[model samples]
Target chain A: MDVTNRIERALTEALSQADLAGCPPRLAAAMRSAVFPRGARVRPRLCHSVAAACGDDNPATEAAGAALELMHCASLVHDDLPCFDGADIRRGRPSVHKAFGEPLAVLTGDALIVLAFQTIARVNCAPDRLLKLTQVIGSAVGVPLGIVAGQAWECESEINLAHYHRSKTGALFVAATAAGAASAGADPEPWRMVGEKIGEAYQVADDLRDAAADEDEIGKPVGQDVAHDRPSAVREMGIDGAVYHLKSLVRGAVEAMPPCSNGNELRSLIMSEATRLVPAKLAQSAA
Target chain B: MDVTNRIERALTEALSQADLAGCPPRLAAAMRSAVFPRGARVRPRLCHSVAAACGDDNPATEAAGAALELMHCASLVHDDLPCFDGADIRRGRPSVHKAFGEPLAVLTGDALIVLAFQTIARVNCAPDRLLKLTQVIGSAVGVPLGIVAGQAWECESEINLAHYHRSKTGALFVAATAAGAASAGADPEPWRMVGEKIGEAYQVADDLRDAAADEDEIGKPVGQDVAHDRPSAVREMGIDGAVYHLKSLVRGAVEAMPPCSNGNELRSLIMSEATRLVPAKLAQSAA
Candidate 1:
């Protein structure tokens, strides 16, 4: 199966395991909806591509990719809660909290996080490698310098925009690359740069979209950066400046690709994804 | 250090790691408050005791125990959210959501869960044992049959009380025992029963306190089962009957200890914990 299909199947199976005979119907249903009718599946695909570049297509790689996607999906669910962005729509559908109520939404996010780790645990791999994969992913998901710290930045009255953006948006992207490498028994440290650049570009794109796109175009609330007083490239720099920065980060991602047998293929993948990350709409808005 | 002190030191270190210079102050504070002044710390203690019984008093076992406590603490924070039980106080203080605001509370819970796995991954053990430790704890925290499922039971209109209680409360206890055993290179399966019985007894004790004790006595709101219409042993079988069940479960925990060189010591530990689990207050209330 293709990477997206594999991720979808893995996610579906994970949710099914939670939806056993006496499982709460709404919680089970929300878990499925939170992951399915998916988003871009960017992180998982990036992970898979990196693993392929490293010359291993093992279950560890697939599992790592799927787990990364699950964590991404989980972040979205929690981010949309009333206490956070309070977004009522996600990927053009009712948000988990909106559809199933806030309690179920909270539970769904928690369950998905657990499922991510559980999925990684089940993968067939060298135990040391598996432990490394878990650490890389776990650090990206948690605090200090992870996505959780990124979101927590909003709670602060003052913040450094660069650090905030990296932790919130760049951490998982970094995790995806590092975990993919670790899963394939390659040096994970070099891949961190690849993830950081992609993640920075992705965050800039998100900022641009939030600043310029309509609710219909974005599939969720727009102008959230302004509404939430969040730190964003579009807010700190103008739309034009943000676009320029995003393109630079994209180039950085391509340049950061470590030497490997599949280096050229990975570069092309990164370039194609860069265009998607900073789409024409962003350019049009900046123009 | 004793288990409680060791667990506290480990947790303090974990939170400090997340409290980097630029980390959001409120998020950092909330994470600390969510775990400090912890309730009984039963899960971590159980885990440490089991690991000791299995003849491994290594850092890996300490890490596993701390991780379990972090997971348990995370659940408590989320469980007390406005959308769930909505309790204003936990462990005799303002709950995380109430003290730090809802957004911080949510983020605090998320960061702690991630911290749990990170702790285990950092353990100084053989790769396979660390992997097993992660799996054992992850399964207890996630869906199909973890604490997440336990909370999800409330969303369902109907639930088998036995399954609800087990998943909601017993799963973590089971993980504590199983993880402790795994950390020692011992077979983990045999230790599961010890956890289950202790967990079941703990739940019944909880139900008894919620049903019969005053708010001051329990350090939180009382009568929550009736208020939320949750499945409870005390509610299902009257307080007296529930007390009887608690005693029986305590006895089962004693009998369930697997044979080891430290069998006599472990049995004594279980009996002491059993008394604590079913305190004299429960007997007085039943009378």
Candidate 2:
């Protein structure tokens, strides 16, 4: 299967595993439905690219991929807590906390955190490499320097968009590539730049969609950033500038890869994704 | 150094590497104080036993030991959340949520989860073995079978005490032994029974105390199980029956260990601990 297809399957499977408890049906269904066909399995796709780059053909690769997705979902679940974002809606539907009571949502988020590590740890890989992957995954998901820190930014009055995106989005990207490399027994350090470059650009792309992309075009509604007064690429750098930043990042990612056979295709996919995310003028329909 | 002291120092140093931002001084102090100068470090001591049993003497054993304690602390943090136990106090002080608001408590719990894997991942063991350790820790902490499931028993209408303790308490014990063995390059399966037996017995002893132990002596307060209407050995098996069960399980733990230098001491410890848990003097104190 293609990387996207495999990632989708893996993510659905991971969510299923995380949801095996005898949860309230409405909550269980909502959590599953929230996950089944997620808008973007970006983290997993990046994971696949890095794994393929580092010659990873093992179950650890899939595990790392699915694990990152689970972590992202967990962050979202917690971020919607009453104290964090107090968000009642997500993906044009009720957020997990809104659909399920806050208590179940709390448990679900807790479960997701456990599930992420479980997924990574269960991957059958060389023990050392698996350790590296787990370490990388853990570092990307936690405080001051990770998604946890990213969420903390919301509670603070002065937010740095750069710092915010790096922790919230870039950290996972860095981890996906690093984890992929670790899975294949790569040094992991070499892939770091590739992850950072792409990760930053992805954040910029996310910023772009905050205003440029319509709600249907992106899974979540546009303009929440503006509503929240959170800084963004579109706000700081403008839409065209964000696109330029993305192109520059794609270049960096392409350049960061080694002379491995899979490198070129990986570069192409990232570039294509960047292009796909770029704004396009729609053709006028026939009158 | 004594086993407990050595393990606590190792854990303190290992936890220092956690560099999450927004760590309030009080939270840091609380985290430090909550663990530091710990009472027994029984879990770490358990890690040491299995590691020694498998002939591991590296500093990585320290990491494995620390990881177990960290995971335990993280579970406590989550368990004390308003949605879970609603516990405002723990270890004779305000719990994490009480000290640092719910958002930070949640983030702190998340940080500990990541930190546990990071600890094991950075250990001196071979990468593959370390990976297994990370996985073991995550599995111990994960849901449906981990501590999260154990906590979920509270939400459940009729949790079998055995099942609850097995998942909540036994799971960690099992992970500790498994991690210790993994650090020593052991297959870890051989030691699974040891953890199960010890974990189950510990819970019975705990329940036995809950039935009659004094609030001052237990240090947390008894009658919590009854207050919460939570299932327990005292509730089902009664105090006398719980003691009998504990003795049998202690026998099983002694029998389960390999014929090694530590076996006699471990057996003695379990026996003494069982005795200490239910002695006439303690009963008098409880009354």
Candidate 3:
């Protein structure tokens, strides 16, 4: 199997094991209903992309890939909690809190976050590389920047999109880019700019879908951002403008990506992903 | 200052700087409340003890000390959520969720977890050492073992006290012990066993209190464990036997502590901590 598919398969195995083994029965039952028709697995894809970009290897790519995805999953669970988004629906099912009790939902999210770090640490990478990856990912998850800030936006009026997106959404992507490169035992600095730019594009596209996509198209509430007055590229810049910026970012990211067998394809995939938000193929029946 | 007082002082300083600039308003507010009457600063005490034993430099000892305590605080916030302990009170005040509402409570807990890792990663230790510290701490927060398991236990049945205490309560203590040793850059394995044993003793004392103590003594609900039918040391061993086991483990922990300048004192402290849990205190209070 190609690297992307291989990682997805591995992730499914790992996630299922996590779900089955440590999960409380109520939680396991809830997750069973919530994880289907999953989103694009965008973060995992990025991890695998970076891993392969760096010449796929053992300790680095596998650990980084699993760690990033686990973090992403944890974020989703928390975001769907009644407190933050109060999102009752996720991936087209009742959210974690709605299905499991709110407390278990909270603990499950906590578990996932810890699992992300555990996945990374268990990798056989040199202690130093594992250490670097842990810091990078940890910084993304915590303070001034991390997912915590992203959720905190709901309570505030003024928003700094740059900082918000950077830590809240972009941090993990940056980690994926860096982690993948590091997995190859190579310094991943060159990929940093690329990761940042791609993350920007990704967030913008998310805004587009949020503003215009319907439930059928997006598989979740649309215009929820405007409804909540949360941050979004469309709110900052109109939808058309957001698309233009996404294209610009895609171009920048493509240029920043290192030369590799998958580099060009990765660039194209990212570009297409940027436009995937259009309520287009997703609303096929409407079309 | 003695290690405990100094580390507690240091922890206060650390919490002040968190989110000082551009912090999410809700996050800042909740974080502010979460730090009040912060628990015993037990993790910092353990970290400092390990560092003192290993001869931690001024910088290493201070950084690891602050980081470990933050993790403990974060875990406590999550644990107190209505979903986990449904604990309306902690350290004699309304728990984080009770004070802030569920959403902010979730965000604050997430932020603290991230902050714990960020603080350690940003600390001045060699990147390798910093990485080691964060990874160890991160493991203590998540998965097959950790706080998540502690929370997950509520959802699973046939409650296993050994595993529950190990993950929810012991992991951080274990991390604190390992972190203490790591400050001096020692091999962490030797200290792990000592921390684990001490952590178990701590849990046993907790069980004894929960089964027999009154609200004024522990400052929280008494007998909640028995109410929940949760397996506990008291349930497992009965009162007198539990006390004896706690003392025996303390002796083992003292003997096992990494040898250092403060070894004798740490042994004494551990013994005293266990001793204070004497059934006499509960009996006197009841009388």
Candidate 4:
């Protein structure tokens, strides 16, 4: 099956276990909406692609990839909450909070996160690999250095922009690569650098879009970085400089791919992904 | 260390790693307060006592016990949110949301939930046991049959009262027992009924207290069951019948302990716990 099909199947099966039959109708609908009508689903794609590069067709890898996407979606749901970004639109639709009300939105995010790990736990794998996958994903979503910590940084008076970017965006990207490797029964350490670079590049690209693109063009509210005084590459380095940094990060990502049987294929994958991730204007300029 | 000391130390160590230095003071403070001014810590006590009864003192048990406490604490934080219970006070102090504002309360709950699993991942255990630990806790906290589903039940127009009580309260108790057994490298399935009965007994006790105790005696709001029209034994079965039911449930809990080396000791422990869990007024009447 294609990565998208695998992810869709895994997510659908996993969510079905949520027993929405007994839950509030709106909450169930909101969770379905938050997951389906998917975004680019870049994280899971990156995860499966890396697992494939490692010569793995393991079900664990598929589960890991699906779990990563669930976490990503959960993060987006919470990030759009009024307490955080307060974004009303996401992926060309109303945010979960905007559609379901704040209470259900909160529960949706919480349930998705629980389901993410539960999804991984049910994957048929050797205990060791499953344990490692759990650890990898847990650390990525957790505190002190995880995405939650990354978001918490925003509440601080003087935020470390680099740490914020790395935690908020880079953490999940790193988890995708590391967990993909772990699920394939390979060492996860080497994949970290590759994931970090991609994560940083994606954040930079988001900053560029936030600064330069129209809200309608982006399909969501724009200029949020400036409005919230959030730390952003575009705000810190200027649009042109941020674009330059993104290109450099993508180059670094390609260089960081671990030597493997499919090293060339993985490099090509990263290159193509880099192009897709970079803002169109920035990509055109760089080209 | 004793269970209380061990719990205190474990929670302190876990919260310390949340990178509070970089997080907002209020967020950090709220997380701390949510944990510190501890409730009865009954769940961890039960977990540790069960592990001890099973002849296991591994650090994995400590970690599991600590993780369960963290999950319980996280649930309390979210449960006390304005949208849910709007509880103004807890444990003789301002509830997390009331003290630190809603946003921080929400984030604090999220971070703590993440920390709960992270705490387990860091435990020194065989990978198999670790995998089981994750499954047990995740299952207890996740959808369909977890505490999250229990809370979601309130949002529904009609709830199966048995399922609601089991998910909302019994799930964690089951998790505590199952996790403790898993930590000890024992089969966890047998321990679940023990946990479920204790949980049900505790909930009934809570209902009795809520309906009958003074606010100062309970050290939080009273009459909440009636206020919200929440399902409760006291409301459903009446004060006398509920008291009779609490005794019966406690007796069942004692009878449900799995055949183990410390069977008598564990039975006695449950009996004492049953005494403590039932309110004095109810106990007097039942006696």
Candidate 5:
């Protein structure tokens, strides 16, 4: 099956696990809302693509991808709460907190995080591969370099742009590539650079969109960096510079891929995704 | 080492994993505050004690116990949030939200939850044993019957006392016993009842305290169950009936032990803990 189908099916199965007998309906629904009407599914796709490139299509790889996606969704749910971004709309619909109230939203995020790990644990795989996948995936969502640390950076008086971006966006991508490789019984260390570069490229594109794109284009509020006074590529570098930097990161990502048996397909996928990152108009203007 | 020291050291190691170099200082501090100056440390003790009873003192068992404690702590931190219990103190000091603000508290809880799973994942145990331990521990914190569901019950329009108590308190205790057994390379299913009875007994004692003990005795605000109009044994059964229930549950816990080699030691530990669950005056009054 295709990567998207694999990810969606895996995710559905995982959520069904959470939607077990006696689960509070609202909490389950809140978790669903945070995940469905998917937002790009970039992380999972990256995970699956890398695993495929590593010449393995193991069920554990799909599970790890789903786990990464769930972690991303969980982070979004928590990040949109009143304490953080306070975003009302996500994926062009009401955010989890907005739809399910704050308390259920909190529990939803917590449940999803647990579900992420549980999804991996439930997969029947070689124990060694499972252990490596769990460690890589777990580290991506935790401190001191995981998304949790990434969010905590916002609370500090002074923030390091590199640290914030890496933790918030890059860590999971790193997990994606590394875990995918690990799931395929390959060395994961060489895959880390690909993830890091792609993650950096994605963040730069996001900043460019936040700075230059229309609100309707992104499906969320624009100029949040200025409103929240968050440091971003656009704020540090000019729009042109940020766009140029994004291109460099994308190229770097393609160059960083470890030599695998099926590298061409993964490379094409990354290139296509890179093209999609910038809005058409922005891409044209930058060109 | 003794159980207490084992639990404390394991917990310290787990927390240090979160206290890494680039972690935001306040977030790190908040995570520490939520855990340190420990409460009863009941869950970990139960876990370690059960592991001992199962004829294993593996480091993985200690790590499982620590993971359980961290999950308990994470639940408490989130439970005390403004959207939930809205408490101002825990363990006789300012709660996580009160001490470090709501946002950090949220992140701290999130970080701790991740740390719990990461703790189990990082343990150098047999792969099959580690996988089983992760599944047991993960189930105790997620959905259907995890603490998150327990908290979600409070958000629902109607609450079932059995479901609430089981998910909220019993789940982790079940995790403790079951994970301990799993870590010890034993079947965890038989140990579930021991955990269930103990957890129920502890909750009953807590209800009695809420209804009958002073604030000073419990180290936090008293009368919260009544204040929040939550379901409780004291409310469902009168104070005397609740006390009677507590004693019965404690007896049941001892009887539920799975006939391990060190059952006598574990039974004695349970009896001693049961005696301590209720205040001296309350125990005497009930007698």
Candidate 6:
């Protein structure tokens, strides 16, 4: 099956579990709204690619990829809350909070996080591998350096750009590679660099889009970094410098891929993603 | 070590992991404040008692208990948020949202939930047993019949008392008993009834206290059910009827315990807890 189908199917199965007979209908609806009409599916695709490159497409790997995407979706749901970004539109539709109300939105995000871990736990796999995957994925969404800490950085008076970006955007990407490798019973450590570089590149691309892309092009409001006064590559390094840095990170990601049985396919995936990351006008100008 | 000390130490270790370098100081502080100055620690005690009855003092069991406590704390933190209960105090102090603003409180709850799963994943245990424990614990916090569903029920226009009580309170109790058994490599199924009854009894007791006990006795606001027009045993059944129900449920819990070597010890613990559940004035009045 194709990567998108695998991720979508796994996600559907996982959400179905949460959408049991007794679940509150609104909460279930909100969770679905947050996830469906997918945006990019970058994290899960990376996870699946890494697992495939490791030469194993285990059911556990598919579940792990789905779990990563759910976590991403959960983060986005919470991120759009009034307390945070207060974004009204996501994936070109009303965001979870805007559509579901704040209370259900909060519950939806919480339910999704729980569902993410539950998805991994429900998958039948080697116990050791499941444990490792759970740890890697849990750490990506957790504290000290996880997405939670990344969000908390916004509240702090002083912020470190690298730490903020790493925790906010890079943690899940790191989890994607590591969990994919772990799901395949391989050493996940070697794959972390690839995730980190790709994650960094993605953030830079996001910063560039926020700075230069049209609102219609990104499907969400652009210039949010400026509006929110958030630290970003474009803000710190000028547009040209940020674009140059983004290209370097993409190259670094490709070079960092651990040699595996299906290395070429994975390499091509990363290169193609790089082309899509930068907005077309910026890509042309950089070229 | 005694059960209290064991729970405390495990929680300390878990929190320390989250309080790593580079974590936003306020976020870490908020997380700690949500957890420390602990409440009665009833859930962990129940979990430990069950583990002991099942003849296993495994580290995984301890971790499971701690994870349960963390989940409880996380729920309380979120429950007290402006969008939810909007209470200002918990455990005789300002609640997480009141103490550190709403944004930090949200992140703190999110972080704690992640920490709970991470704690269980980090523990060393038999792979199969760990897997079972993870599923049991994860289900207790997620949707359909978990605490999140319990909270979601409040959002719905209509609410079923049994479903609300089961998801909100009984689910974790069920998890405590089941996870304890699973951690000891025992079948978790037979332990469910004991948890269910105990959880129901506790909720009744809470209703009784809220209706009759003083604010000082509970260390937080009382009469919230009336204030919020929430469904409660006190409102549905009256104080005398609720007290009668509480006693019956406590008796049911004792009778439902699965036979094990340390059965008498667990029985005694349950009896003692029942005594503590009812406020002194209510107990005297009922008698």
Report the C-alpha displacement of residue B46, candidate 4, in angstroms.
1.5
Q: Per-residue lDDT tens digits of candidate 3, residues B1-287?
A: 77756776766666664556656766777886886566667677777767776776456667777777776777778878776678998777888888878777888887777666656655655766766776677667665566666667667646665667787788888888887887778878889988898888888888888987778777788898888777788898888778778878887888787556557556666666666755556543322
Q: What is the lDDT of residue A87 in candidate 1?
A: 87
Per-residue lDDT over B129-216 for candidate 2, one digit per residue giving the tens place of the 0 to 100 score: 6767766777677655677666655555466555567778898988878877888777888788988898888888787777776766
Docking level of model 2: acceptable
Please compute DockQ, using alpha carbons, for every candidate against the native two-chain complex: 0.73, 0.37, 0.50, 0.54, 0.82, 0.81
Candidate 5, residue B166: lDDT: 95
Off by over 4 Å in 2: A12-34, A53-58, A154-162, A212-216, A237-252, A255-260, A278-287, B20-34, B37-39, B53-57, B156-162, B275-281, B284-287
**How does candidate 4 fare on TM-score?**
0.95
Per-residue lDDT of candidate 6, residues A15-87 (tens digit): 9976687787888888888889777889888888888899997999988988999989988999899988899
- Residue B286 lDDT, candidate 5, scale 0-100: 55
For candidate 4, lDDT tens digit of each residue in B116-218? 8778877767877877888899888877778877877776667778878898899999998888788888889999999999999889989988998878877
Clashing pairs in 5: none
| TM per prediction | 0.95, 0.86, 0.85, 0.95, 0.98, 0.98
lDDT of 5 at A152: 92
Write out fnat for all predictions, comma-separated: 0.77, 0.48, 0.62, 0.51, 0.80, 0.77
| Residue lDDT tens for model 5, B1-287 | 77888888998999897667888888888988888988888888888888889999799988898899899999999999999989998989999999888988888899999999899889888988888988998888998889999899888887766778999989998888898889889999999999999988888888888888888888999899889888889899898788888888888998888779887777888888887878667878655
Candidate 2 chain B lDDT trough over 10 residues, lowest sum: B18-27
Q: Among all windows of ten consecutive residues in candidate 1 chain B, which has the lowest summed lDDT?
A: B278-287
Considering only chain B, report the TM-score of each candidate against the true chain B: 0.94, 0.89, 0.91, 0.96, 0.97, 0.98
Locate the minimum summed-lDDT window of 10 residues in model 2 chain A.
A278-287
> lDDT for every model?
0.84, 0.72, 0.71, 0.82, 0.88, 0.88
lDDT of 3 by residue, A20-53 (tens): 4543455445443434345577776776676666
Clashing pairs for model 1 are A18-B144
How does chain A of candidate 5 score by TM-score against the true chain A? 0.98
Error of 2 at A272 (Å): 3.1
Q: Rank candidates by DockQ, best first.
A: 5, 6, 1, 4, 3, 2
For model 2, how does the per-residue alpha-carbon lDDT over A182-258 read when each residue is reduced to its tens digit?
87777888887888888887887777777777777765667878897777887887766667777788888888876
Number of backbone clashes in candidate 3: 2
Candidate 6 residue-wise lDDT, B123-181, digit = tens? 87777787787789888998888998889888887887778889998999999888888
